[model samples]
Target chain A: MVCRVILPRQFRAPELFPQVQREFGRLERIPNHVQFDFSQLQFARPSGVVFLSNLTRYLRRNGCRVTYCGLDPSRDPIAYMDDSLFFEQHCGRRLLDSSQPRPTTRPLMEIRHTEVHGWIGFQLIPWLSASSGVPETELAEFRTCMSELFNNIQDHTEYDVGSVFAQWYPQEHKLEIVVADFGSGIPRTVRTVEAIDSDANAILRSFDEGFSAKSRPTNRGAGLHYLRQNVLDNLGGNLRVHSGSGVVRFEKNGNSHQVKLCEGSGFCPGTMVELEIRTDRIEFDEVNDGSFEW
Target chain B: MVVVVKDLVSSCDTNYDGMVVHKHVLSALHGTDSVVVDFSGIPNVTSSFVNCAFVALLQDFDFAQIRSRLHLQNVNRQIGNLVRDRMKKEAATVA
Candidate 1:
């Protein structure tokens, strides 16, 4: 039997998790062929692109005959994916037809880190700062936050490969970033080091300031905390993490921060982090009074 | 002796890159009583960068020695905070 899945019109993070879980559940029940219809997709963020890539890969690996259909070249729903090289790396082909003249410029970036040092420096920081109009110094905090996310995938997950898709919308004055990994999810990896009651708790524990799953000199466990601080506390951005059978969302609406946790009906094979930063809200001049002499 | 952070690493983002700079600092620390870590011209830094570059020093040296010997110069307030926070966390972890 063939299973058909219709893609969402606007696919971005925080909103994308429940839909992904629903679609994933539908795809799981099917025994054979699967068709992912993308005609309805109008706007897609980096998280959406990564999710599509990961989902496609997951389905294909599970012995299903997967076909992508209903993609409209005119609407350009796949622009972010195309710009990020999601189609090229994941599907071994380009998304845009050769005959179609490609748009000269787009704000999306796709980072696939094969090794550590070369990718993170000049190429990433300028793009993020320039697009967001945030000062390089303030953006540095975000750079550190993202770097830690990349490090987590490399150091903790069995799969060394990680993908990051980021896009800045000048009109909206917002930057959205998605970092993903196809490996053991957070719960499974954390369980390796300490006992965890559930995937949700494992995710919650990860946010605790100095919690790292690894032991001794190597495990600093400051990545997630820094991420939370920079995104939610510093930039007033929204953060969502989906892994295994749980999803956690941290959103800052004005002065109050709202956090929500839910158990997914379906399992995400790995971990995905989606963050949205409102560029206008970032404080470049903000400084901490606390100092470290040691 | 001064080890300009920008000269050591192109960008201060990841821990691995920080570790590379940390190695350089460790080597620099051996010969001199004090070493200056200048963040001049460096655009940005992360907690992981701070943790790997400076906070990890706690593994080998005492906090007081590191405090006395290592001088952070030209760093912005954010980088300063990140370094300090990572140091405190690392101190708590080690203790």
Candidate 2:
């Protein structure tokens, strides 16, 4: 029997997840044939596009035959989805709804962990820099922040594939990047190594410097900490991490930082790291001028 | 001996690449008085890279030995901070 997932009109994350989780939260629960009904999807956020693409891949990886229905290229959301390469990455085919992926769209990508460095340096950094006026030099820190998240996903997740969706909004001078994967989340992974009482606590604790999910604990825990520091604290960007049922959001409020931890952000399969960068605000790094400090 | 990071890995990002750098650094240390890791062309690196390439060295060599033997050149604040932060933590644990 086929399970038809009728998506909501506003097809975005932090909301779409809970509804979908009710369908395929566990591997044992996936139906033989899963059909994603995107007819009702009127608005698609980067997070939602990447999440759905990732969920589809996850289902297929678990032996589910995934199919899409109710795609109307004439609709604004469908056209946007086409421009984002959502259907292309999802099915290796495009609706040809738009002339091309468009210059403003970063396009969706399913990058293996091994290819992350190249993707970030060769494609992601250049794309973000081109649209946002964020110098590549200043974006180096952003690259480091992203690399840290990739490191976390590589170390913690069972899947090697990470689906990414990025969009550069030039008018707003903002860049949105979302990377999602089908792996054991921060909570489940942290629970393996430490005695964390809750998912929110596990994610929050991961932010502590020198915390690693490795059972023996190597030099492995700085990914989340550095990400939180650089993206939220240093650069005044936004960072949201969704894994298991935990959601950690970092927002800058005047001089103070807003750290919100939600224990019930629903079940986000694997983990999703979403970043909204104020591309106009990035500046050059002044310290550590190519010298070692002993 | 100078271990140019770009020469070791096309992109300094993954654990496998980090391990590759670690082995090369170990070999360089054995063959020379000191090894300077050149991070000129590499834009940014991850903690996995730093931990495997630099911090793990603390286990085999003390902080003093690391300070004396292993050096970093062209290290930006981003990569340098990751290496230093991780190395300090591992060095403390070893001590």
Candidate 3:
């Protein structure tokens, strides 16, 4: 039973039911169970859990046998396991495990570029998202997470050799992004600017607010910090970072956890960040129109 | 033709004169035997910037027109991907 994925304004606003209705129509003609991948959608302002609860009710009435593919839900199932009730209330019964078959590994996009500076990481994300059918809205946040790291590389390095290698494993159901540059790395960038003895501890603390080596018109070094809160804290994922030979890892699964400075390396000219994201919350959809918004 | 070296390419904010800079660079390549586009002053650029600027110029001026004459100096890795992605997307859409 092949599924027809509808995107953007193919359905109208103020309600997601129209999207369901169209899919049901297609199903009636084809006799195949329908799946709606809302992953590419960008709602003007989501009205919280009530709207989702109502959607569940409407789909049940139609015996649509529906399944949701894309929606960020903005909360992590692993991190927020305590409040399974909370997720059910807002996201309906089709939470984490029930969404789709989780992959042991997935086909990953590998981008090799030596000229884009820190962008290998950032650029890899869109291509991966687009190829994997990760919705643009969720993809935007994923890119933001990588941007925090990419921006750091761009600001801190003058490396002539740059490389970004990433893999999206299906069984792991995660996208692992690794970016490396042969520049000053994190220690030198911090030592020269902040006069602080550089180490993994310093880099860890630097993810906090007011911790930038450079000052811009509107930045507070909050990219890493924000990522910790949203993707790690809110999304139930893992962040592993190694810079200047120091390594620190953060993982959240219904609680915050970390493993620090367990290893060091001589690969100190630049930074390497590996971010693993589960595909359950990923919505692969076209970015052409408002089916999703950035 | 020597395109007046204005500024190197940057991010994809149309409000930031990046679009204008790109247009000027493209316009200078009217019928010149060879055109050199300098990016000495530019630091970084986004995929969208290359799409709206350089890739758009390529779209406007077919490959045969600018292939040999056009040269981008100080090409960064990020901008290269941006151009490549935009061109691929444009080509896919056109075909």
Which residue pairs in candidate 2 have backbone atoms (N, alpha carbon, C) closer than 3 angstroms, thus clashing?
A: none
Index of the highest-lDDT prediction: 2
Q: Which stretches in model 1 have alpha-carbon errors above 4 Å?
A: A1-3, A8-32, A39-45, A61-64, A75-110, A115-120, A215-217, A253-257, A286-294, B27-30, B92-95
The per-residue C-alpha lDDT of model 2 at residue A286 equals: 62
Best by TM-score: 2
Candidate 3, TM-score of its B chain: 0.67
What is the lDDT, from 0 to 100, of the residue A288 in candidate 2?
51
**Arrange candidates by DockQ, highest first: which order?**
2, 1, 3
- lDDT, candidate 1, B1-95, per-residue tens: 98987777777866666899899898888888989888887756766677778877887887778878988887776677778777866676677
lDDT of 3 at A141: 46
Model 1 C-alpha lDDT per residue in residues A66-138, reported as the tens digit of each score: 7878755556666655655655665566677552212322223334565433455565566666776676766
Poorest lDDT segment (10 consecutive residues) of candidate 2 chain B: B53-62
Model 1: how far is B70 from its true place, Å?
Answer: 1.7
Task: Give the runs in model 3 whose Cα sits over 4 Å from its true position.
Answer: A1-127, A215-219, A257-259, A263-267, A282-294, B1-95
Error of 3 at A201 (Å): 1.4
lDDT of each: 0.70, 0.81, 0.48
TM-score of each: 0.82, 0.90, 0.42
- Which is the leading candidate under DockQ? 2
